[model samples]
Target: MYPINTISKGGLALVLAAAALGVPLAAAEPDDGELWAGAESRIQRHRMADAVVVVRDALGRPVEGAEVRIEQKTHAFLFGCNIFLWGRLPDAGMERAYRERFAALLNYATLPFYWGSYERRRGEPRHEETERVARWCQQQGIVTKGHPLAWNNADPPWLPDDLDEIRRLQMERIEDCVRRFTGLIDRWDVVNEVTHFDRPQFVTIRAPKHSAMWERVGQIEFARQCFRHARAAGPHATLIINDYRTDAACERVIEQLVDENGRRLYDVIGIQSHMHGGVWSNAKIWEVCQRFARFGVPLHFTETTILSGQQGRGRPRSTPWRSTPEGEARQAREVVRFYTMLFSHPAVEAITWWDLSDYRAWKGAPAGLVREDMSPKPAYQRLMDLVRGKWWTKLSLQTDQQGQGRLRGFLGDYAVTVTAPGKAPVAKDFSLARRQTNRWQIVLP
Candidate 1:
């Protein structure tokens, strides 16, 4: 496992106590600016590993001076965007552009499974549509995650008024989705936004029927039941409890989402950061990481939105928001910074951008990495530079006298080609991850 070099809970409490008492704690901690400046170093220390590639002949003789080429294929850490536009674009050209750009940059795709839209009618869900998208994602080597198996955000219009029946159907839906997509999509946001499931604003106006059903079942009980059903269905799946709030409210809900045996139900903790209002400060981002790291589960920034438009004050639908040149520039800079911080933090395993394009983004806000016309934004290019260029590893090396070539590179899937003088080129694929031994042997033909 990758070591987390952050302060422990006890140490953090001591630091807090010292601060409260106006006492100095050994050395001062780095500020936000310092953290940003040192992000690259942190990334190198945490996100990379060293591997020794050994080359030999079929007779087990060391083949010294062999030329070896290493190239990265995919990231173990998921960088994703919602594939809500998979085949839903306006035209074939737009669809083609979307697929090309998405596959070029991202190795993770979030498939939409919103209850209201996914299954508009009872007993009939959009399984074929979702399967088509999942198949495409598999073909492109992208990991697929279903967004929200359970949420009070919206309910199907065909939902029944009986609370008991609603609960049964909800659990059945969770199990069905999890069981059906077991291998195709092994990750899920099991229960979404339970911290504010019955918030007055949402319960009254947004999803009254769903909220009422959730209330009757009780918040913690609802989450517990949903997680249990999901776990039973997809035992090997990475189930997550997702929430928008980063405060104590979220922590409370997560703390209580345990089985009868006191074991946590979720495999990951999903945090939503919709920055349509504004980008979160560096300090806030780091604080969120620290807060969630205590759960001992990987953190997935499930639905992140860094808008490439002027910040508006009213409701998203009511406001006329458009992406501008200046805003795109700022978005590019901040996107790099935000992603770097998250990537540097050890607890964060994945980061999923909200929308891939602004064509039909949530709330009609301009929050896509690409524009409405399927053109790349500055943010898109800058992120590509980081994810595929700077963070990616490509190298050429010669084996030493011991027939070993050593390299330190970012942890991910890699392809290696070894060519010795007067010998056929030999190629092999390997993966570099934290938990596994990274040594590989390539026997030349």
Candidate 2:
């Protein structure tokens, strides 16, 4: 196996009445096997079904030279979750539990890079904390990614009145991040939520009148400059243009990013699927994918969250968003379906679930796969069933005359065991990257 390379949900309703009246209602959980099957159909669809490998005997001889066969087992997928909690949880037990649980399931994590938080005061960036998180993720074999090098929501407080200086500083910020995180964390949401500046209420934090930065330098230009700076610094990094809105305006921004020669300014198209209100219909989900797929670029569902509690109906923080048994059950079902849809789409490369625990989740909503107490919720187990349990690849096969055996399975890292008459079994590791043919040679003992 390649060395551990340091890389770097929906719910709703009905329960509100019960909670108000001090009564509870039960929510139905989808059949585990059925959900797994649906997810498998998408995960192992046309894109990934089989891998071709060759097994050699103890003497470094192929089946053609010495009869040999092998057994293969898939260990994990590149599936990921976000760790935006400044790299540590509150309670010691919770922190250990959180990291352990997170490492068990996810191989990727999205680190926070909000401008306001990282550099609330210019020249005093919070690098030490973020670096700690990135290193921890690396030690756990999880790839780390930085989010939104440029975002209006997390705008710095010490901006000058000059638009040119603001633009210059924004580029400088991107440069500093890409340079600092060169290999520690390469993937970045170069520009986030760029599609909707007019939606005043959507801004998560303070913003100047008329959204000064984007307006001063045309929105498109501002985005282009951010990407340009990021690309210059971290050419190997996966630069993404992300947004929460899936409207015509977003599509236009996507189209404008490509050059006259059809070269794109960004590497990935990031879409946020915050299902706090409720799960989106399959048709609507497909429509959004098809719309973005038109750009012919890889897509990443950057920030997805589904509540395991009563939705806040637009005031998630002020109101109570308690998780009920019914709500969690429903969340499990919807989360499975949502992930299945995204995985099946050929254009999608990754999906980062927004929150891991309900504790201090965005706006303090119960949107985590795990409860605050560090117990696995139905959604968490359901996802595990799809990713590592049912959809995983494990099988034994015999090699043909050419010392070759074909194994059809999910895309991930695999452990191959080779055994032959009078020869002890030997193990070898190989990986199946998405859309790439994986070939391996395993020598027996």
**Candidate No. with top lDDT:** 1
Which tens-of-lDDT digit does each residue in 174-263 have in candidate 2?
999889978899999998877776456534346562257677788787788788889899889988999998877787787678655768
How does each model score on lDDT? 0.87, 0.73
| Residue 131 of model 1, lDDT score | 97
Off by over 4 Å in 1: 1-29, 313-319
Q: Please write out the lDDT profile of model 1 over residues 49-144, one tens digit for every residue.
A: 999999999999999999999999999899999999999988999999999999999999999899989999998999999999999999999999
Positional deviation of 64 in candidate 2, in angstroms?
8.4
lDDT of 2: 0.73
| Span of ten consecutive residues with least summed lDDT in model 2 | 1-10
Give RMSD to native, each candidate. 4.2, 10.7
